[model samples]
Target: MADLTIRNLTITPLELVSVERFQGEKKRTGNVVSNVTGAITGFINATDFSAHHILPKGDSHDSRDVSFHLDPFRTVRTDVRSADPAGREVLRLTFRAGDRRYETDVPSPSRKSSVMKRIDGDDDVDDALDLTVVYVPTGAFLAIFSSAKLYAWMKQLDDAWPLPLLSIPGTHNSPTCHTALPSVRCQSVGVPEQLQNGVRFLDIRVSVNTDNDTLALVHSVFPVSLTSIKYFSDMVDDIYRFLDANPSETVLMSIKREGAGRGTDQHLSRYLKAGFVDKNADRWWTEPRIPTLGQARGRIIIVRRFGLDEEMARSCWDGRGWGIDGQHWPDNCEDGTCEGGHIRVQDFYDVTESQNIEKKIDYSRGQLERSAEREFHVIGPEHDHNPDPALLPIFVNFLSGSNFFNATCWPERIAAKVNPAIVEYLCIRHGEDGKGPNQLKVGAASTGIVVTDWVGANGDWDLIRCIVGWNARLQLP
Candidate 1:
């Protein structure tokens, strides 16, 4: 099979624009007054049609101004019968010239008529008609919200900042997982569920105006973790291959950890140094610090007798050790030679807990006491300079397991720090009027384009989608 490339698909891609609409307002008529005075007041104060200036002949109109010319497009209606009563039998076509009056009847005067069109070829009307008239008013034109235009404009912006494509879901080791669609000719990582589902989503809309002559690319990565050594190496190869295929456009990769015990900055540095990440790549710092509180919370007690991970580490490495699925802890007491090697499991639990335990048993009490007090203390602080401050509280909170502390909050905190550029706000769907606030979305002031918030799980697919959407919107060449 041929190798996939990310560049071929982005060349001269489709650009989208949006259009919006609103219901017209009803006009009011006074029932109190009768004839001339009321008619004069209503005619002069009418809001439907108002007077605007008509430039003199030979005067050039500004395209940016309200009086610019528009092509005459044909409009067809079934019948004019059930229309307004003001012009009951008449289509009351009103035209404005430079302060000239031309009124006439029509057996369907099906000729080209604009705000400048006047009744019959009268000399006075013709003289006034010589000047320019604005066909569509600025107010009415501004009121229209075109979804098509919005989509188109967004597509233009997306051309530069393309969104990532999503993939179908699958089951892996009893967990649900989703992946990113493969680039046409670039390598892609097989992100596991543990690494993928930690991203954030916001409900927002973006608009961009890219009529200017500039090509720009916007990109971001959704970080995923890899436990297996093979998967990690494979992911690195895919990223390097992706960068190789797209030398022209900019790309960003967002890296996130699945959870504690997954890995750390050292792991990422090793991957990047191994030439997995492109040297020319732009890196956006997110979730800069991760705490080790989960695995180290009760280390003070667990290690006071037997060191934590070291012991587990030794057990896992020792051929004859049978405890902890052969996993090794960080302490050396499992060999029975260290200073704390003589401490009993009962003493260990007593020292770790807030209160003293009075119950004693003969069967599995020793093992139970050891396991009870240790409770994954490997997740806590090891030294003075821990980067992730949030880790300690999370680990301490786990000891209580109260409903007050949020489980999702920790993941969110980690996710937030992953991408420093991500605007801090919740993207929410609109109720009632179906229009959402701008608070959740990011837009460029120069292009007025709304940033795309990949509407899926906070996983690799969503992250890649966000980047691809940005590429498409920005029209990055």
Candidate 2:
């Protein structure tokens, strides 16, 4: 398996463009008597088309601007143009692999087309053609798959598994992709990409701009990036699109207040209630209880990290009474039970004084061990007779840490070093010998909601793979 590799995968789409043209003539606006001498004539206006025009004969046209790069595993590009000025003919695709190339005018199964009408005053029209490449493995690589295909494994699990019992992959500072600041930027991908790659948990920090009267996503005071920050409404729409497409999957979003505005928390709370929670209450799990896999499907579980005033609390729309409270959340507490077993946390982000990298890694392992111990108590004789998934506590682990002064302790740096170590430990059996400490036993109860930064960076997915692999024990003989 170490020597397994993908040789080549490429896709190219051809000839699918929409065009629209508009023409108008000038006319006299004054009275008929004043236009008796001579009337001014109107000329044809500019024409609009959905795609770019091909240059005349002997003139080279560059179509590279219309191309798109697909996923990291493969490269794909699409180009389209009319062969004649009359828009009568279209040039097709020529696929190239190795030293051979083949030209074909027939459309493949991957080709698709759609037309979009302009809603504004402009009469322009847009015709879009797309080609989707589905990579089907051949030879020995057929048995291999990436962690992004996690939905296939999740569908096989029992619907009775509580959301807290399963291990989940999460991203920290999930929407800071446009920011180049290493200290503040944590994620390399946007929310949609993260969701597509099996990230079920999101650490979203929001702030209210009182001047603009809009809710925006922010990471502390750093503005996230110089580029335009996404509005909270846009973020919600993106989540809805993903959930609507994949009904079997569920997302746990943790929202908190950032920035120094006076009534920012209250303002955000109101906007969320009026705009989202009130209108789409059915799509969300806003109750103050843990849910099972079957109950949470096609819904977004809210984890509010802000304080609610008395007025806001009285209203059912207040999200503070939702899934979990970040205020009551314990810091670095490894017992896996906080607020009398209502909430559990594994947040250990401070690594400034750590002598070596192994110290942070050991702390994470110890936390998971404690989480396993708590799960065992539920399965033990004390509560075995009356097992309830709702009463079971939730475990939230943070695999992200940083030290601003030392570049070696940045989020990416720590993740690069610690993620592999965690995967290696999870792969070993309880009695086997491995590097460092062996506190955690490899099984179904070993992990829960492991969150981190830069998840698909450098094509390293060992940590997420191990977390998903641990579920195999639940189906054993």
Candidate 3:
């Protein structure tokens, strides 16, 4: 466990767009995506390479299977040693792989003489030390082109449960009214179940206005705020069992999230300590960075309001970490910059005079609520027994956008199974290509996209506590 495990790097079709080209070869001029066949070679001259072996090659079919053996090809362990520099036992490792052909030297423990020089003969030390250096590769290659784990991981992500709903307390004067809304489900990219043992789940918040019929309905599918991470952690064992039973096959693990305007509501410091900081925390199968209940405990800021005027928008932009570049505009606004980006609004809604509708709103005088507060209820498979609670939020956030179409009622449709009539309605609406129940997609063969405006006025709006996605990437492996 101490040695570095060379996890296979995965490449998506999207990742290849920038790294290759085809003029008149098997890949036509129009096809930029390449299979990218290559080999990896690793070299280690310091230690004995005779004890190692190569991992078995995968089968021809089912590229997803990776049909290789799990037996670690190599292992390294720490051993005790005398005369070490740090007065601590030194480390020695035995590298083993398929056919004992893959072995290399690792950093050894400091000699006691070195340590004595520094400490002036302060303490005695052990005689010998050995460390475990494990290897999982098949060939001598280093620049591997395999993405089996990536796809496998994505598939697991697609199968988890959706985000839980936020129960907003109602006032005596204004009672809370509850309604079952549609739920969103995340899709897994595809990965074998066996490799999902240490994967982590996460939940994020998003927001949408009432006017956005499709988006609202989609966002409405699940409550964005106030989810319990305990539920997801509870199901980890079951997931592992499922994967263990199915060795070579890939499966998806879908999870839901609160969309549009909602945010997280967890004990920030405690959650972070458990998922992000604890050195001994059990996170073998967890996602890299866990979004804690602490960051978005109260108000889940999914979106913000910014004035349509370029100047006002600029002012709002300046305040955000993403608005540094003006040339890239919305999509490229990683730090509020306009460099190398495209606005999502361009794909779904029209950008009128610089107004990003998701942020600003103008309420019809009579329809305005006393406040921006409301209650929502989300329904899906229940999970409440896992150690990592931060995953629920992260899973929900990503699942909200998994579908390619606007008919985001997939979760509700599945839940409606408990209610015969609702199931019928869902089938009737989404059954065929634009021939299902929700007349929304029944007439076309396109990815359903739903969007509408709730607030009328356009201006710069800022959703409080926006954690840039880039920041999250830094902490990931």
Candidate 4:
């Protein structure tokens, strides 16, 4: 028996039959007991299994009869055993293929296991288990699944559902991953890593470096780091690579201008047009309108947070004319929709005079609730009124905050307080108790993009998981 490399090792409930001996009575269907401890046991050939079995010789021919061993791979049922009761359960699996029975164990999701390994021989086995299986808690499955898998699931939804209707997890100061300065360093991982880890929106702040005639990523007024750092072009190249590898997905990049220089906005705009946007026009969604998933595939939707001068706006590839101009995006507006229901935002980062953390949570929640409220559009004439549920505006919730005093209110600290609450709020809204199927649904009218900092810092992904899991409800039945 060779070590069998396993992939896609998901765990599902099993109903086992129980037998009792009393006064020499044979076991009957009514006497069977069910295991209620949620213990995982055994393996089944999920790919190829049927309920019908061929009738043996001298037996009444009834192909419809359900066979006791319906699964072809169940011949070695006796080999299956209950997992250990210690820290986390483990299920040992054994399956036969061409006179060889390979063996392996499904590791606990709580403990990180080697998802992929190089095997010595047998190309067929290698291909069979190429996709690694992970057993996560029912509600947090989306956190473990790859971004490519999540996009495939999104493709099943109605094409009319615009991007704003979805719950998108984003990063605040996305390209500040390399900064060593504590106050300025926002993310511990770079843009490419964040994108691959299911981040769909990126908060990019760019500045025009007059010295080198180049565009660079800036945090406030200074460069991203005290040392050599990434330029805006570098960030764009990384984005292009990720998009090329995963063509089914789209990215919403909120670009804002920062740093000091005369006509910096125009300079940055011209640089982006000639260097980046012009070359990748087809790869971008430049129209100032919300696009359906089908229309936005393999593209980057620009969300310009800076004003464009006349010259810059007239340029052939001006981003200000792209997707949504979040420039005059109001600060802390509780109204659900802004710009005549075209844009929605929740950026209440001013916590200077706040008395306690509760006030911050309350303010943030209020903003989120406002975004979640339903909006409608008139569909008929004035005499005969018909109001249909309209596609909600793009909701950009800034879950990051800071103040001169108490650096504790920094983006990372604020996320620590708000992320868990957001998860809990979603669980309550979806009526999830963590024991059954997670009915995680953030309808087109609810929570939109959640921008945070230091996500996955200290291994805390509950926020991202909750946001991603919300899309699980859209899966095809």
> What lDDT is obtained when candidate 1 is compared to the true structure?
0.20
* Candidate 3 lDDT score at position 362: 18
Per-residue lDDT of model 4, residues 1-477, tens digit only: 122111111121111122111111112222123221111110110111112211112322221211111121011122122332232333433333333333333432333221323233556663333222233222222112222243333544454456766667889889887745555777767888788777889998877755455777888776787888568887888888888888878899988888664446656656666677788788888677778776887899888777665665665345336446677778754433455466777676666643545666665565455544533222333322122223346778877666646666555556556666565454433322221123222222245788877776534454665566555333312
- Tens-digit lDDT track for model 3 on 1-477? 232222111121101001011111111222223211111100110111112112212222111111222221111121211112222212222222222312122121110000011112324324211111212112111111111232122232212212111101100000001232212322111111212321222122223233321111123335321332112222334444544553322222222223443332122212322433244233221222222322222111221112122333344335332111212224311112122221112111122322322211211100111111111222334323244432222101111111223332232221111122211221122113323322222111111111111100011000000111001111112
For residue 102, give model 4's deviation from the true position in Å: 21
TM-score of each: 0.22, 0.63, 0.20, 0.63
Best by lDDT: 2
After superposition, the stretches of candidate 4 with alpha carbons farther than 4 Å from their true spots are: 1-159, 209-213, 311-320, 332-340, 353-356, 375-391, 430-445, 475-477
Question: Would you list the clashing residue pairs of candidate 2?
Answer: 26-42
Between candidates 3 and 4, name the one with more favorable lDDT.
Answer: 4
lDDT of 2 by residue, 1-477 (tens): 111122111122222222212121122344665443222210110111112222223222333322222332222223332233233322233332222322222111111111112222333323221122211212111011122355434665566677777767787878876655676777767888778767888888877756554666777766677777666678789999988888888888888888554456667667677678789987788776778778888888887776654576775545435445554566654434556465577677777744556777777776566554434223432324236767777777777787778766776667766765565444332112232254434333446777877665533344555566455434333
Model 2: lDDT of residue 178: 66
Report the C-alpha displacement of residue 403, candidate 2, in angstroms.
2.1
Candidate 2, which segments miss by more than 4 Å at Cα? 1-148, 151-153, 210-213, 315-320, 332-340, 353-356, 374-386, 429-443
Pick by TM-score: 1 or 2, better one:
2
